[model samples]
Target: MIAIETTGLEYTYTDGTNALSGVNFEAKEGEKVAVLGPNGSGKTTLFYHFNGLIKPTRGEVRVFGESISKNNIDKIRKRVGIVFQEPDSQLFAPTVYEDIAFGPKNLRLGSMEIKNRVTQVLHRFEIEALAQKNPSNLSGGQKKRAAIAGVVAMEPDILVLDEPTSGMDACGITGTMEILDELNDEGKTIIISTHDCDLAASWADRIYILNKGRVFKSGIPKHIFADEKLIAEAGLKQPVIVQTYREFRARGISRGEVPLSVLDFMDSVDVKVMNIRCAIAGCDVEAGDEVCLEIKNGMLIANKGSNGVTGRAVFDGKKGEDIAVRDVAGDILQHEGTITIIRVPGIIEGGSRAADLDRVRDILSKNKHQKMGAMGTSAKVLMTRLGLVCDFEFDVIQSGILAALRGFDVTILASGGMADRVAEKVKEKKLKYSCFVL
Candidate 1:
């Protein structure tokens, strides 16, 4: 189902400035869509049409198959929440808590329900500490979080964010994206306009490039970034990952689909294992022999022997690397490690219990060697409150899977829908894993 669609969208300011012209766009239900463009490219103007913030000068804007108009504008606004590029534009209440409670109050929700919604958003956005602070007194990133929380408090089905991470720090950006992913998992359509090419490539399901008040190109990230001419013509730089992947392909080091992330790039590298003469004296190895491979002094060494042929694993290796090799058939070794997922629940109706934290601690103590990761806002907040640090923070799911492939035990803490996402990604990688809920 299409959540939002615009046909021949044209918006002109009162001062004779045309912000959007013949812009046709659509965002599917529960999709993560990105609108990319340089400044003054009509990205903001197009976003305003999604929620009926501004009427188009020409053409139509539809939300959930209904044309947006004054008769249904109130209902449409309730269904589609918009977070502006500038936090100050959205936040005006005396306190952050009030700012978040504004939307729900306008909906005439019960006072208790409105309070609950504001509280949930504050905690979800990790802005609970700033709830009572004046919005004008908060930092740039804090103000952004407060603004987003204000919109999310309305529980809109479609979230439209303009430059959501414009003033955020690295950690703030990661946490915000994780929260958005969690919302999307729960079937919210997430539409964001950003100048960050790398973020759009890695996070968005589809991207639309806007130029001169029109959509210059629209496609998946791989195809959008692969066209150097299009990128240059739009006055945008290719994502760093795409640039690096192109260079690797040119150097004959990588093949297959263009990589959009670090994990994809690693998967694209063509690492080949070659059979070579035994480097160790008096050592013999044959095909179809079981041998233990370990990295010693930056070299992959086969310890056991059989028929004078030592399998040389020609790939990057570091000292102290010990990956158990079960079979050496055709000089290929199979290696795998366990991945354990811990599902952290959202804030309980009353409050979370200390037993939950204890359970997590017990799991951590049992898996001392496991690389720990937390996915989504709830999981990260729980980990932080428990005084536990995560080894993988930004790309927790892919990072955990990568570590498991490298023969390292991984423990991921995920909340709500993200737990299912972690399991799905791990299953896609064909790795054995376990999940526990606390």
Candidate 2:
């Protein structure tokens, strides 16, 4: 069922401000949708209609097939919970618990049930520690959580958020999106409004671009951002990562769909870069081990690795084995010069399911940790299994090596087949570089 739908959705302010015009939008149940536009676009105005907070001047709004009118406003409000952009506006109760409990309390639910709901929201948002704090005393991130906790306590089927991460730091923004991801996983339909195209592109399944009170474009992010004319007409630029990819494309250096994030962009950078030669030394390394080495690129290059096995760097980017990085290379840090890579896939031969991908979501987003993995037997089939919301095409070993050359801080070393082959090439060139294993 469609969680929310609008036809010719038009709204005007009492003083004659034309907020929205003929905006037809739809979000199916359990889907994550994003509304993107500039400051004066109708994003906020459209959000108000989703839950019947504002009466439409023209057109109609529906929630689960029922028209949003005075008679059903209360019921729609319950199912279409909204968390406004500003936390101060939504949080007026004296205490955090009171603010969270406000909605359920209004339903005249038994005191015990309200208590249970308040507790659940606090835990879900990871705000149980702040349950007794005054709403005014909370930090900006805390207030945002408390505000969202209020609406979530209502058990809404569809949740509406307006620039929920507007004033947050990196950690705050990541934490907030993580919660929303979890909520969506729990079956709540999500609709959000923001000017963050990079974020929307990386997260949303579908996006609607609004301009001058109308939806100028609507589609998946890949197609939407590729349209130069539509993006220009809507007064928006492509996502930052897309712009970088295009710059590479314009110079005839990169190809394929634009990457959605830094890690993805790393994978997309041409992987056929020149291989470096180094002197061989240190303990012998196998399929799953860590090695430290250095090289030259004007600056001395160092290789870093995570504690886990780096099995990804050895696989033929297609079918030899499943791929994953050391939670550091070809996935996390972004830098601006050349570096050398030394570690190889560290997992013992025939190893599989080394770590749980689901648990890494928490580590990756807020902590800014790097990650790459797939639960398959080949690189060709090892993507889209983590529910990351972004698309990627990477030759694990080559991508890692190229990323390291382009100044990636950490990367796995090449082992066995590729290592031996590259060693022969180094001998053929008789360059100063030598081969080493660990």
Candidate 3:
């Protein structure tokens, strides 16, 4: 059965930006389809259409072969469940339990039936203990699970998630994937809109590329991901494993094809090492991993950025330092030279200057932490919003300053503290060039 289908689907926002145009696709029952695209590529708009949240500006949308019209809107909504991109947007009930039960209650189920459904969903999502906890107090991953549990309680035939695994740590990602897989196994159709190429490649049976408000390509993961030209054109980076293998090939090494996983790469390396042969002659295969493998000389490394100020430093083109060194009063500390160092002066109430608004904006863009309340919910977001890329010590900061003087592009460390010893570390590291003293 056709779970969902769209033909000539086109949508234009009120701002006059075209979000999607001429999109034609269909998902069969129990099929997993991944809509892959860069940011602002209409992935979210496409998903809204799936659940009838957004009426089509043009074209046709059918759920289970039933056209989405005024009479069927409510029915279609009941059959399709959408998990929004942001969990905070979906979770509004005071407690996790009430949030999960909201859908069943809206359906007007009897008190006993609603309790049973909510209990089953909470258990299924492994969030039984959080039933009484406030939604705002839940962790990022837990909040995501709660949002999903609420959707599952609806018993929708088609489960649509927007960036389902976004912002999750390794463990959280794995757990979510397992849950999705289990849901699929139970005969639910799953459709995901995501920018995570790795997740899409590993989990999606079929992949669709949406670019410039149109369908650029549609095929299996292996085929679409393997096409270097297509991936580059689509503004996506190839899988790291494939990139590594390609580099090896360019160094005069021969491999049959790019490996999809670590184990596959190791297997391919084994084959190449065992079958070493000159380019001028036919190859002879040797048994086992006994053949000698010779690597060409002259190593070259792609320098992404430098660490100090003096030694062949290349800036990341980010104007101004991440930390805005200011006095106890709010002031924009100016940089004196090419290298500047900043630090919090000491522990005084509101002693350090407020964050540089521009720098904060840049960090927010890079980390996608612009969503409201993200900083309050996740410590990682707070650190990142403050322009802390990686954890570093006071010693690193001082060393970075010295390295900057030596022509090494030095990076100032941001570990919030209020002490003379810590502040001295910032100066010693040569991070003091334009150091913002909070």
Could you tell me every candidate's TM-score relative to the true structure?
0.85, 0.65, 0.61
- The alpha-carbon deviation from the true structure for residue 411 of candidate 3, after best TM-score superposition, in angstroms, is 48
The candidate maximizing lDDT is 1
- Candidate 3 per-residue lDDT over residues 1-438, each given as its tens digit: 999999999999999888999999788999999998888888899999997888788998999999898888888988999999999999998999999999999888899999988987775566789999999999888888889889988888999999887877775676576556556755789998888787787678798999987899999887897799999898777877778778766765537666655434543453323222221101232222122221111111112222211111122212222211111111111111123333322112221234454664443344321111110112222345565553222123333333333233333323133123334544543344333333
Pick the winner on lDDT between candidates 2 and 3: 2
For model 1, how does the per-residue alpha-carbon lDDT over 273-328 read when each residue is reduced to its tens digit? 22332322123444344454533322345655443323433332333343323323
Across 1-89, the per-residue lDDT of candidate 2 in tens digits comes to 99999999899999999999999999999999999999989899999889888888999998999998778888888899899988998
**Lowest-scoring 10 consecutive residues by lDDT in candidate 2?**
373-382
Clashing pairs for predicted structure model 1, backbone only: 284-306
Q: What is the lDDT of candidate 2?
A: 0.65
Ranking by TM-score: 1, 2, 3
